[model samples]
Target: MLIDWFTVGAQALNFLILVWLMKRFLYKPILHAIDEREKRIVAELANADAKKAEAQKESNEFQHKNEEFDQQRAALLSKATDEAKAERQRLLDEARKAAVALSFKRQETLRNDAHNLNQAIRRKTQQEVFAIARKALMDLAATSLEERMSEVFTRRLREMDDTIKEGLADALKTASDPVLVRSAFDLPAEQRTAIQNAINETFSAEIHVRFETAPDLISGIELTTNGQKVAWSIADYLTSMEKGVDEILKEKDKPIAKDEPKPEEPKPETKS
Candidate 1:
């Protein structure tokens, strides 16, 4: 076991050279490859994280859009409901107005029919009554009552109101033409004299007179002077008759009311 320094030193130097060579070629290259692989893995993980974030953002946007669509749909539904209600009310109002108009038209037609019937009745009555009055007066004109008629005429003339008397007096006194005394029949000489005397006594003035027979006078007497006239005709009696007929017609047109309510008849009992 004697020590040999040269051989040991030579062997140690050779081992050191081998270690350097291995470190420079094998260890350094392998470590560099591992670092490169780790860097690549880290970059891949970062890319995956970015993709995840983008997907999350897109999901949130889709949810927000869905919510907005729901709100718009609800608003549209509400609007449609409101419009339907308004349309229904409008139709009801139109129907009500149409019904009212129809009722008014019915009432108006009824009133017109009643008025026409009443007028027809009035016209028929007037024509018949006036014709009868005219015939009766014409028949009466053939009688021998000239003196009495003259006396009646003078009496009527005297019965005028104060204002009428004054007017007649002025007309008679100032008239340039003679006063006219018309009758349905001729008068005798004594009757004419009596009438003249009555006129003078009633008016307290001398008035010129003219006598004439007028068949159209209808058994009446009339005096005319300066466009003023005093007359009595069968028309007076007809006026009274007309008034009586009007009262009767009014009574007939009135609805007769029952003093008591009408009793509802009892229904016959069934044997069952």
Candidate 2:
């Protein structure tokens, strides 16, 4: 090919212009868009990392608060348990003390009642015994000897003053119809004669005397005027003494009623 300097220069200039236009309009704009996109992605990644750190800090704080609450609850429960146990023990102790006091009071009351009862029984028994003895003595004295006793009775009557002698005379005069005297036992002949003399002397009248024997007098003399009679007996005297003694004992035992009680005995005291 023949060499052409002007034409070649013109073509090379045209190619250089085309390359400059393409770089400014198409390639240059595309490279600028890519650089902008890369810058936005870096900013978004940094924002996400900051949000994650804040969330981790909040979680740690919540866990710490929960642990503190648990510890407080545990302390409160322990205190309540201790208080409950103490209260229960106190109630039990008070109840036991009250029960013991009640028991002691009941025992004292029972003892007092028993003592009073025993005293009542003893007093009643003593009164019964005295009454029985008095009745027996009075009955025995009512129906006994009278005959032989009249002579001695009239003799004693005559020994009294004239007034007493007159009284005896009147009493004997009324019975003079019955020459015989009734007695619990027989008298000796001498005793009979002596009694006859006394009766005649006291009455100022010649009075006949006779003797009758009876065994119911119980060691005492009985005198009968006709059907009327006067008598004295050992048993009657003993009975009076026994009654007096019983009254005295009852009074003495009154003081013992305030004393400590006694247990059951062998038997009651013997009375005459």
Candidate of highest lDDT: 1
The reply for model 1, stretches above 4 Å from the true place, is 1-146, 249-272
Residue 22 in candidate 1, Cα distance off native in Å: 99
lDDT of 1 by residue, 7-115 (tens): 8999899999999999999999999999999999999999889989989999999999999999999999999999999999999999999889988888788667756
TM-score of each: 0.40, 0.34
The deviation in Å at residue 206 for candidate 2 is 1.8
Maximum-TM-score candidate? 1
Question: What's the true lDDT of residue 212 in model 2?
Answer: 76
What are the C-alpha RMSDs, in order, of all predicted structures? 11.3, 20.1
In model 2, the runs with Cα more than 4 Å from the true position are 1-155, 161-164, 226-232, 252-272
